[model samples]
Target chain A: MKKDHIRELVVLSGKGGTGKTSISASFAVLAGKAVLTDCDVDAADLHLLLRPEVEQRHAFFSGNEAVIRQQDCTGCGTCLDICRFKAINTTGASYQVDPVACEGCGVCVRFCPASAIDFPKRNCGEWMVSTTRCGPMVHAHLGIAAENSGKLVSTVREQAWCIAVDKRIPLIISDGPPGIGCPVIASMSGVSLALVVTEPTVSGLHDLQRVLALARHFSVPAAVCVNKWDINPGQTERIEAAARSAGAEVTGRIRYDRSVTQAQHQQKAVVELTTAAADDIRLVWKQTAAML
Target chain B: MVAKTHGRAARIAIASGKGGTGKTTVSLNLAAMFGAPVQLADCDVEEPNLNLFLRCEQLTSTPVTMLIPEVDANRCTGCGACGELCQFRGIVSLGTRALVFPELCHGCGGCIRVCPSGAISENPHQIGTISVGQSRTIRLVEGRLEVGVSSVSPVIRAVHQQLRDDMPAILDAPPGTSCPVTATLLGADYVLLVTDPTPFGLHDLKLAVATARTLNLPCGVVINRAGEDQVGLYQYCQAEALPVLLSLPDDRQIAEITSRGDLVAHVLPEYGLMFTELADKLQQEVLKVAGGRA
Candidate 1:
């Protein structure tokens, strides 16, 4: 399946829970040997379905966090006064750095008169390369309350690309995080095509508009697929119309189906099921593949 | 649970480790059923939408700005101290002058503090906007992050500033167990976790609960779309002694009205008592936790 131009397709939803991960999983199944990646490192759930077996693991160190050495004890509040994130705790006799709140800005480290603060590499998360039923996959686990998700996303995307090249897969399908923020931008930056999976709802439409704008802002070619379109036909039509007007390809629509859940329960992709939802998702893949 | 307030008004943050598990739906309904004035802050700054549902006509919006280092070129020295001090490369002294990339700056004021030449200063950079409005019993303050801004903490803090100490506040946190969610949940009395009753729900709920614990915030669960509890979401709650406050049915009608941006508590009377009970349970838990601390 190797090609001169390796197509990277990232499935994104500006809003969450609109069948983003499920459809991305199905796309991996349809592609048969594509390199799969989940950019939603904070809550990476794609592994639930694909069940990737870890092959290579890498520690993701992004930025630096300040650690106050209690023994250095000048008890000066210089670090506390200059801190903007409220990360410094001035309780007891000395100050302590609340690792959860520290943004690792190095401001507190630089200004401490006693120079008691130690700037250390922050292990924000971990990204891993694995083998899934679909194909080779890459995923990550972000430490609880960790920052630098955007950096971790970028790392995962690179690992996915490397795997795609090594495995000679022509396509890489990424399950992007839900939001049009840093992580979302990092995932979709230079993709060949992006499939914006959205439900037909007011908040859905509202977030969709923002996502489309983000795609346009970065010049990423985007296609739209309405999940559970039957729940709100009028809103579906409106969303499709909006997508068309926004110069995005309205690829297809999927009706809400219990089989989707059943497939999830069995740790399988929906397209593996002989159900209406499976058929609709296959059509979506067909059209989406064409766009790529 | 730094206890942002002492028996004043509890800040209840509705959060989920996974997205689209009905955090917004639960927070809005909880506010509606509070039976008193409550502040609903949409701290999901990237995809803010409580305003979409509330549809408040009169909104006063103010841009949120963070102070980034601005070097005074005329101060006449590429001391390189500012560059050496900044780890983010926000301001790198190229031997001749310090280049300022405001976007990369975390607004930590380190470069300004470490500058020996006293050249580095602070400049406000707009990251987002906060809009204040009112809807029935809820005072809505929504944060909208300007596209292209990477950090949401500054914007989330701005939204929290609008929380009234006199009224109970419900924070609609962004999904995931990351810094953004922490920024929204910090200093809250209790965290109301909304989750679906499935593997993904339970799995991420574990992460969400861990996050709540990391902040030392007491939290309970509301299982969205609960069925026979096949996935052990209930068992997990029971095992951990985390109270299962409420279990919602997998009703398409509820989804129908909710997707249309209508409050189910208002549109469907049957669900009104459900929310009232949810509110009461939340209040009771808050009171119990407060009393234990006392």
Candidate 2:
């Protein structure tokens, strides 16, 4: 039993604009018993699809933002010019800080001429452990246009792993952020397997190659599942061959289905829809689960 | 002493504040419409999907390398100077040793900046690769960042090396207005922000437009889902004095075509006309701003 106590996480396609969240939401529903984590902290949308009920909330401090106090000193613009983020600006009378643009480097605060600028640790986002109708979900909402998505993703994944360990669940189905950038790297690292949900497109193949290479770089076993595979069967075949060449397997190929939109409109997974697409996704889930 | 003049290409960038707003779609179509002597650099290296639309045949690839800190155990004195100087807290001293997390290192040479014992040295590591290609009609360049490498700016800078003096280059930027997006739009003449009309879309749009304005780049909006939501996009563009060059309809046919790895311009000839018009408009705008010639 102890040996069977293994934690598993899954990252979808490296390409954005794909239906990664939707497919992962469907899997979350079918898992019957598993902890879900939304690792797409940069543009967290799995919460929209999962509709989690916040059971606990925690403030996340990924980094800091510089705050300039106009009352404290002269309008010396040393901090403004030195700021790599261009986060500080003069508003006629006072110098103000744009929190979103600030990279939180503290260079401005450290070298303020008047010592008026201070680097304040900001609550850039909120991480939550929630309960979904399907299962317990761990997610976070990064402040609007905030940076440090990689850190936010790592925080959410850590919480999800903790929950899975506490519940004695072997699976942690994570809806990772798209792209092979910081957030994607954070989501994919240390995962047992990655199910890359790609389409049959040039960008799809290109991104899949990068993501698969990332998996190999991390020594994680990866599987490919082509979403809307019927849209371009030729490209799908190419992706399949590429996956095989990369020493990975194609777990499933989901066809393009209009009912997917209808199910999403109803805030339901495609597997719950009374359509053939649902059946295909159900099979995809079966294979993905078996791999875990 | 002689003064030298260096000619540079007109670098244009196609970006969106939000994902799924057809940035890559617009970038490829515009590149195709621009005719010859145009280089399409897919700087969305993390997902470089423009190749899907362009169907480019790759030629040369340059690996993007960065300086990662390497600690010489013999020279390291557990001084913790490197750790203390690291603003990112990437370097940590564990008892008699120091650990350098390559992922956290920004390659700023800051760790080496404050290393007292000269234990820290620069180690060149490949973070990504930049590839040049041809899509029959257009020249293509793309950056693919190696996974697990946290930094992508170096790769983007690497992709920037393929620009020719007279060639019109279209930079396909990644979504969001972060460091990566800034890197993509650094030297661009004009930035076309492909956005939709949604709260999240609008929120990020404001951030990106502000960024473009801060950088003193000429910008305009291209609403992807024209009919779906017009009020927010139109209102924002009107308020900001940003021109709306193109508005793509939310047609499922376009989606189906794009999903099939085919460019919309190829499937829908009408979209080609739109791209041509868009390119013309951009040219006129560029001439107006930069003036006919030096």
Candidate 3:
């Protein structure tokens, strides 16, 4: 509970389906006392393995949505004419706004001569605080077609940090979203270490470079773990060389195993199952723990 | 095979709410089945893998640029109209100077219009690149986001601009149901949602389906790596009345080939026939939906 005592480790894969969630869940099982947060708000899968029971839920409101009051006056068609995104539609009698397409730019509201438009806060998604077999977990779901995922990710991390500090947890483990976009940036900001989980393929190598560059850009120290390294050992070696030249340490590698999928089917982390990959994951976790 | 034609070339977008669910695999195979007069655009700028499968000869590369507001310090007054007008928080005034965050800018151009001091001027900032190439008879276009750039929707827009209108186009959307995915789904006539059978896969598929429904776009499902234990995805698709267009079973041979940068349809001719059938079914579905709309 001391200030600046909580060290954070984020598990990320630049390309999706490279075993980011599976690895993070296994790490949670190994690091029993760490507070876990799934920062992949868009397609979070950690809860599937962690089986967190919800303790608190809060609605996330970040953007504006405009609504048209139909009975104000003449259908001047001004809002439709000025809208750039083509978000406004007409039924030949009145004008309406498409909630999904509307960017909430407020241009239509300002240009409406009838003053019949109302801009309301949009309920984009919700974040939750829950307890799991591992520890306290914070996660979220971005509403369908809603924007501002980066903001929601930051909110989830903030809640996770508060829990870590209040409970005096020494570490916070975050499962990050794929791609080097806004959400990834939000997840990487101020994290102690970033453990990038990558596969051994051309696409995997290409994306790992980008994610490493992003981590370096944010000045967050990054480590690499090649998942499914045995699938293509040649590419796996190439990835490790690339990571090394880029100043990232190759913490460990996990072998390809169908039991990884079997574990997912059972809603359990790989380490919890008797699989060959579980031993490999434990090795990766040991190295990752040393870095922390 | 039944020969079919449309009034205009219809666009079919391949998307998955979760990454690594085989969006690129399905898109590449479908494009291969079409053979000629087909264009495939990889809008997953962050990690475009279609080029790895298809042997594309580069034709041209174009940079995608956005107009970001630049504040001129000498334009007199310290009014903060531009700062107050931007909804995205792209520009902010701090005491004496205004800071512009180009990555946060959606390029709405409202700040320049509302700036009272005439200090704001638009500047071009390159965020990514769009490349067009030829892979056999297929026209391939891909967007590659430059490192350090946060937004990718503009690059996707630029790639869509390269679509050849006279031919059918297949767009491979980025993973996740966010702005980048929406940018690719914008004008598509139909969407082929590819997903695996897992709890995570079903969870994100619902989000993708909801997004397509919000745009009023008809969609079908393609189950990748279909296995024995994952019947949840099938049940959900059936209950929703969503047709399962095709299912590719989990085969170790297919996985090995794909891992080596080879297409399953090319290495295994039997899968070619299946993809051709998929293309035909897609054409039929598009026509049926188009006919219903008319």
Candidate 4:
């Protein structure tokens, strides 16, 4: 899926709330005509900043869900004993499926003696093709307590790629989810460059290394930027050293600024304002743009 | 509401829809303020850093495994039934035999039932490990998911499996309104959502509130980084009827101490009262809800 024409840059952080969305929104504004995507489907906050207007919406379906026909169910406790997910609830005369707990393994559906279980496609969430003041964008809202975030992330990326190709967009800016897990990996594939936003702390350093290792494992080139580097100068230096040792480019450092919050309150990217952090983000964009 | 099995131990889960909204900070502080007889569970298994600040002495560690199918080729009939029934494609019939992928398996056991030859059996596949430790009076239980493992619910369930019936537990839920957060909130008596006053915090907090409502759990909000500019968030909370249980200051001193991995309650001393008050309020809520259990 690697394209020679478009440069897709993904903003990621192993830890959450490290300004990934803030930085990505700035990059979108800077890129101007790029295709934007919010890969953080679990707790998507990019749309709050971009304020995209939805033009098209698509239903997302992934995996199967089990529903018991209560009228036909015999309350035999057979599915309860067989389910490992603890999804089957017997608090009533007839067994009920706790949709949140049910992983939809379909084990109970197959084992039911009366064949009372129904296996249906799970409507996990919805993905949208929208238009922001910046440009065409893609985002999604994952159903509450629903699984398959990784799948939803993939779906968003796929639609973004299609829109980019269709529109002949030369760039893509994505806001990625936190953690070094499945959803994070799903966002990494076919990405041209990864900008890892991190803060200055022990947990930040610990998680940054693990995420760097994941990037190395996937052979995805990554650049690390320490957000709020002034808060802990010592830890910031240590993190930069680690990023260097891990063969990643230490791109830029942003100070902890109140203007970042002010910008958020206005639903604008920090780069759109006159602030020290905006200058720092511009330098990051300059460096990242050169690499791309 | 589920009935409490043991004598008076309220399970309070501190969760956030947005990442880095102080779920860990709140959970750790409340556990310290609760002062012993409390179980601090780190259900955020993917990148568990509670051990970073807790610094407890390790007691025991156990691997959490999911049952995946191991096909016995010797007894195989190659009927392709296993592949046909598997929704996850964890097991596939390749030409003459069935191949099983442990990582892909949901451990549903459907393939085993579908196989006419009775060739499939289940084996334990390690996904994560649960470790128990003690920090002064509070017992710490943290779940660490294996690096490559995708399924986090099993590891979360393993951490909860270590919860004691008699002692109160403060669960540090992973950020987001997805399945993992839901898994942590399910058995809790009350959910304390910690959020900042920023617009991003308000936006994500709405999602978390919807999730708690969908799960039918009684919950309240704690606004971190509280500032005068929080009229937007305050109004939303008022409109939603979500109680603001506590609000921490938007002070630089708090951030410096917190980011340095110090429990604000222990280091600042005066701020300990906030957590103490939070504990008393949650205790009343738990007691009130315990009586109305199904």
Please report the candidate that would top DockQ against the real structure: 1
Candidate 3 TM-score over all chains jointly: 0.93
Pull out the clashing pairs in model 2: A202-B52, A203-B52
* Whole-model lDDT, model 4: 0.87
User: Per-residue lDDT for A103-175 in model 3, tens only?
Assistant: 8878778768889888999998899999999999999998877774589999999998899989999999999
Writing each residue's lDDT as its tens digit, candidate 2 over A67-145 gives 8876895887777666545567777868888764566766667667688987778787789999998888999866644
TM-score of the first chain in candidate 2 relative to the native first chain: 0.94
Each predicted complex: what DockQ?
0.76, 0.20, 0.58, 0.71
Relative to the true structure, candidate 4 reaches a TM of 0.95
TM-score per model (chain B): 0.96, 0.89, 0.91, 0.95
Clashes of each: 1, 2, 0, 0
Evaluate all candidate structures by whole-model CA lDDT and list the values in order: 0.87, 0.76, 0.86, 0.87
TM-score of predicted structure 1: 0.96
A81-161, model 4: which lDDT tens digit per residue? 988777888866878998888888788888899999999999989999999988899999889888845889988998988
Q: Lowest lDDT 10-mer window, candidate 3 chain A?
A: A141-150
Candidate 4 segments exceeding 4 Å error: A70-78, A90-95, B1-3, B6-8, B291-294
Candidate 3 residue-wise lDDT at A60: 94
Q: What is each model's TM-score for chain A? A: 0.96, 0.94, 0.98, 0.96
Instruction: Tell me the TM-score that candidate 3 gets on chain A alone.
Output: 0.98
- Candidate 3, residue A7: the lDDT equals 94
